[model samples]
Target: MGQKKRFLLRLDEKLYETVEKWSADELRSVNAQIEYLLTEAVKKAGRWKQEQGQSEKE
Candidate 1:
């Protein structure tokens, strides 16, 4: 693991509410849910590099 970059993200109200609900259902914070979604998209696009000793499932 490494230090995570931080930035402000502005989302549409409806979209935020949707993500909030989804995050609760998944037992993850909104931030975690967003990161997870982004990671999955990247992997699906073959744009994510797997770190040493890290499985794709991670």
Candidate 2:
């Protein structure tokens, strides 16, 4: 875990509703689900680097 940056995100109603449902299904808060999805997307695209000595324990 690392320091989290906070900011505002403006999303369309339909998208927000969909994400809210998905988050509930995954047993995570909407914010957590969004972070999880973004992290996965970055990893999938090979655009994020693993911290030194960090393990892929996810």
Best by TM-score: 2
**Candidate lDDT (C-alpha), each:** 0.95, 0.93
Model 2 reaches what TM-score against the true structure?
0.93
Residue by residue across 1-58, what tens digits does model 1's lDDT show? Answer: 6999999999999999999999999999999999999988998999999899998776
| lDDT of model 1, residue 11 | 100
For model 1, the stretches where C-alpha displacement exceeds 4 angstroms are none
Q: How many backbone clashes does every candidate have?
A: 0, 0
| Highest-lDDT candidate | 1
Q: Which stretches of candidate 2 lie over 4 Å from their true place?
A: none
